[model samples]
Target: MTVVFVLGVLLVFVAIALLAMALRPAEEAEGLNRSLAVIEAIADAPKELRKDLEKPFGERVLEPLQQRALAVGRRISGADAEERIRRSLDLAGNPAGWTVDRVTASKVIGAGIGFSFGLLAGMVLTDALTLRLVIAAVGVVLGFFAPNMYLYQLAYDRTNKLQQELPDAIDLMTISVESGLGFDAAVQQVAHNTQGPLADEFSRMLREMQLGMGRAEALRSLNERVNLDDLKAFVSAMVQADSFGIPIAQVLRVQSSEMRVKRRQRAEEKAQQVPVKITVPLIFFILPTLFIAVLGPAAITIMDNF
Candidate 1:
């Protein structure tokens, strides 16, 4: 009976030792896991951070405000307005960071500013409520259309520049083609050498061609974007030449000569109009100054003598 009791106590001690051994690794593993989690959190602190906290006021506040303004403008504007704006943008060479949304938002902002200024001016200038409201309404109209007017002016100026540069660009292409480069290579040469909207357009057209668009289609696309009659003619000629398998060098030479003649004619026409353009200033300004100088002394002498 004493031996059995001793054996039973030893068995109990063994079981407790086994249980301790089993729990030791698990506790250590749990602590290691917690440490690893802490290390990972420390390592990923920057990546897990909110990026908006570091952004500028323009991006965080102004951008959202602009977006809301854009929504309002879009709701007020119809499809035709958007299309016209898009067309104008394309013609303006799509100025950097200027989008349809931005322009629309700008319209709203401009109108608000104009309205405020007009109200202030009216308060300072007039006491009548009707006249003040009229002035404010006029200001609103002007402000609302200001962006459109600016865009139209930009598009017109760009178109004029493109027109003026086209002849030179074509001449360069002609030279390149005459020097044994293929049509595409000649276009690339022009794009690389020239520095203007013409070169920019050529580069875009070349990209379109490279990206699996047919040459004729690319030319048509360029024509549609440019909104110039001369460019349209050039595009039509190129498309025809491509369709008929005509040698591009000959076409380019002919086009270059035509462009030069047209440019000379334009210069001469402007030269002829110089006299007409100067007439108003000559009569109203120069002649008036001369008359005033010449008559002033004589009139003063007569008045003094009489």
Candidate 2:
């Protein structure tokens, strides 16, 4: 009995050490902690953590692991995790604008939820301790990566939306310029007249140009922010037109036409892909069901005869 007790104690210590090793990756842990701390420091943090986070934003806002506390604060205050992340990033200097904030928030939330759900699923599906642990580990990994997947999707959607709008915007600008407005004035007019994600971006570009950024530099920054191939091509065309002193209206008209062609090609390509995409479902689902319906009665009849 004494030997068993000693062995049990050793096992407990070993378990604790393993947990520490698994959980204590210093940099990542610190980053999570800092994020929690910053969240708690926000004015709307719950009463309990607010007192703790009352210290200066820079210090307490980046303190140690406070996940439980932050979670509690969130529950009490009803703050959305994504919104909290956006506010935190804004306060921290808004690098990459709201896009970075969205990606970071998604990653943090995805990892936490994924790991928790995965572990819960493992517990429900298996009795083996090793399998459970493996599943939990995989859950954590998948959760951490899930946010990146979402971010990529968001970027792709945003780029596509911008591309879809680009030709229309360019055509509008072309008409405005040809109708007697200066190029800069036409850009500003388009920025004001349209209302969408693309217009928001154009407004920012107009602001930058008005603030004394060179036209080329402003267009480059716009391209970087939008990060769409079509927008980049449009920017390149505009730069060439400006450098060579060509008419802005002609440049806009040509780019607009090219963008329309590209859009048409993309639509055709997606239409062509539908049959290939449908094949997997037909093979796996419909075909199997049809086979079962046709063969099931025949098999049963044969068995009856035998």
Candidate 3:
């Protein structure tokens, strides 16, 4: 009887331990669910509550912060912004005009957009004060320099367009010269007929020449303003031909043919590069899809059997 009693006691203790283990997880899970529900409630709070939460801590806290931000804007705006941007553009050999009002407006727009995106992203990703502050600082810096970046992009695009149009302009100039027009007349004709950055530049050069600047000086100025190697080469060729009394028509014909050949070779080179560029996407995106298509069903069947 004693042996049976001890055995029954052991079974009871085992049952109790098992019951405790089973209930522990449920209790913990319930607590976790409650915590999560609280968090969701906080997140889904009304817009007014959110605004109140986002408001600056107090008048003492917000006043200084507002003053500092205003100071930053004033410093950035007053630091020779126009001169700096104009010099950078000039160094890039772009003669496009930029206005002070445009620059200021661009900076303001950039700052606003940056601040908004940074604040929204910070709220979405984290609730950490340090991280939010860092994001805001970065946004402010980016915004301060955004106008300069935009101007650089514009200059680069304009330069590229002019480069692409140069060969065609040269070809047309050659045709005009070969048809018995003078070199200056051919350039004027190309400038008048074409509508692009290059044509505009040529038109400017022609105007300078008409205003008593020597042909060579006007062409050199055009070369400097455009800052294109091809234009420089053309200028050098013209200067040498003029000095050596070479036929201008012959010089134009030779340069036009060479330009066309170089253009064709560039096209071929880009075409060849396309296949190599496609290989990376094929390996990363296409191969994985193919593997999934081929092996997925077989793997599923094997797992089911196991």
Candidate 4:
């Protein structure tokens, strides 16, 4: 027993050490530093390829682990999951540094860690072979899917935020256009003055347009990226307006008004559902507690008298 306990303790410490190492922040190099390195690489392109006599210790150690993780992920994850991950990343406004491959790697790493931890737990804490194997299997499955689940949640939350922020962004653009700014200028104004995913999308659309993409195409891409109904409606209207030579300001005003109405309707819908949402808690928790508190003393008195 003593030997087993000591081994378990050692295993736990090793796991903790590994976790700390993984969580430690990497050294951040500045943009200029990166540019200078790139310049040097370009300047050295003509030189013969010479192998580094001594690679950085961390790189030497980590590269093999990263490769293994990627391989493991490739084996476990399907192409469909990868495609879905890409869409989720887009929906999440492409949260900083999070990409499909990164999430896949994380899922692989998590599975490995979970499997190791489960094995150690089973050895230290259980005697039943079936239970131990089951625990380990469950751990592997959970770890493998956890990253995808988190990414889905991020996409869902960001979609909600985009919906919430859209009406205001439309209102801003409407105001800008009514004040005599051209449609493109109004879009630029919204991008510059507003802050949110919608504004960021506007800025990206403008950049796309500036890069020679048609305004209609850029607006379509914007709608595709967000996958929101209101934005899609606005995009469709704008594209139609441009195609038919309708006044841009009129389109803007109509979109702005409709978005406000939709926002209010959403609010009212949620408000109406509140009581329904509260019903389960009220019955299961509050009513039961109230009944116990009110009837407990009376029941005790009746029992005593009997």
Candidate 5:
């Protein structure tokens, strides 16, 4: 009770301090453009404007919590875990501001939430200490793996989108290239005219090249970012074409054809699995319902006669 009281007091004090800082007026802060300076300079700019000038709530508050949790996560996390998380993030297209540290911190946060919930529920539902501890342990395992599972799903969804969009992007680029634009210009055209993960990647690659990175290096990075075999093959072919002076249009046309073929194969594979996927549903749901409907009237009549 004493510890809880003290912690509550500390939380109240921190909340008060945060409110005070938010209300306190700033004075001649630099680095902001003139409009932002004027916005903050106002004695009574709306809360949103001041918010824009200050460190975002996430950065100021959540970031510290994440960092603290990440410290605990790092203590328990193996070196290979971090590497695998980074690779997974790459496969997920590295959503803006996502990092390995954030994911580790999320796992820690999730585990704590699960443990607390499990502990509370166990205490409320039963008096057995052993059972409560078991529940809490299960919670810990589920929470620890939850973030990774979600990240994997995200990567899978993004990769599928990339695959779906690849052939169209390639065709667009081929058209642009054959229309007298150079390879880079054709890529720019595709970026401008289309939209998807693949286009975003092409745009990023263009920007990297514009910033003085070699084409081969930029293309290699793109391949590293995505986890698709078809994309890897296309990148390899593009690199080779660039290196050997093969026409860009020819390379794109061939890749487009291959991508279409792969897309069809994927569709057929998924189609073939439909029956297998439906087996459990049919046994547990549809078949039982049909059997009951077909036999139910006869069974009732026979029971009446008996």
Candidate 6:
């Protein structure tokens, strides 16, 4: 049994080493090929066009740094790093120039900055090696995750705005459909009339459909991007209705009604939690201040009498 276990472990280690060796050469060759292509293009281009084809100084300088940082990030990141970051970027409205590569580089840069600052602060505040190491480690962790945290906040705020605007958008669509407009026209109306993430998404969906994509596929893309339960439900209903040849107007009406009800229920749920949320502050802050104010003068007087 021991021999079999030892052999299995050796085999696994050998497999991993072989895979690393195989992949490393491919990555190196890809980088080399890109450099060669750029050199060949530069050599073949006319003088006038060569100036235009040449990259900016900043780009030339940052490209190598970004590659290094990206390497570091990939080493530290999980297998799903690209997809996860892409999904986050989508949820965050896909901010301009914020590609997965840039985000990956930022993670490494952030960690480096964080570690430097943490070590400096630790040196100033303490001499203990263990404490300094702990602080520095904490800084590294925070720095590494800062980009992700920012993305999460952006996604959260955007999702909330989408949820809040959805019911109104649905109502508008329902009215337009009832007034004899086609479903796509109603969606265009929402896209043009409303504003915010929902409007932007609808506009994109319209574009997708106009570019020969199916309505159901466009809607599924929208749903995947938004990550809102209400939006998901609405998309599913619309897809089902389209698939079964049901009336779009009736489907819009049902969704609009449900949106209103759900919005109301969400409001009520938040209202009901107010007291529970306040309890912590009441106990830790307000009650103590009140007791101090009420009892202090009486205690002083009693002390004088005694």
lDDT of 4 by residue, 1-306 (tens): 999999999999999999987776555445657889987886676444434534677578766777778877878777698888888788878889887778888888888778888877888889999888888888888887887788778778877888998888888888888888899998899889988787888899999999999999998898888878887899999999999999999988889899999999999999999999999999999999999999999999999999
Cα lDDT tens digits, model 5, 1-306, are 999999999999999999987776555234346677665577577767677567778898997999899999999999798899999988888878789988999999999988988898889888999999988888888888888988899899999999888888888888888889998998898888888888899999999999999999999999999998888999999999999999888888888888888889999999999999999999999999999999999999999999
Over the stretch 44-106, how does candidate 3's per-residue lDDT look in tens digits?
A: 999887785667675657456545555555566767866765555653545445555445555
Which of the numbered candidates is closest to the native, going by highest lDDT? 6
> Tens-digit lDDT track for model 2 on 14-75?
99999998988899889999998887668666777667546766465433323443454345
Q: What are the TM-scores, per candidate, against the unseen true structure?
A: 0.81, 0.62, 0.64, 0.75, 0.76, 0.79
lDDT of 1 by residue, 147-244 (tens): 88988898999989998999989988999999999999999998998798989999999999999999999999999889898899889999999999
Task: Give the per-residue Cα lDDT of candidate 3 at 58.
Answer: 53
Best-to-worst lDDT order: 6, 1, 5, 4, 3, 2
lDDT of each candidate versus the true structure? 0.90, 0.76, 0.79, 0.85, 0.89, 0.94
Candidate 5 pairs with clashing backbones: none
Please give the lDDT score at residue 16 for candidate 1: 100
lDDT of 5 at 18: 98
Measured by C-alpha RMSD in angstroms, how accurate is candidate 4?
15.1
Scored by TM-score, the top model is 1
Better of 2 and 4 by TM-score: 4
Clashes of each: 0, 1, 0, 0, 0, 0
Superior candidate under lDDT, 2 versus 5: 5
For residue 220, model 2's alpha carbon misses the true position, in angstroms, by 0.4
Tell me the tens digit of each residue's lDDT in model 6 across 1-306: 999999999999999999988778777989999999999988988888877557797788878888999999999899999999999999999988899999999999899889998898899999998889888988898998999999999999999999999999999999999999999999999999988999999999999999999999999999899989999999999999999999999999999999999999999999999999999999999999999999999999999999
Q: Show model 5 residue runs off by greater than 4 Å.
A: 1-63, 80-82, 124-126
lDDT at residue 196 of model 6 (Cα atoms): 95
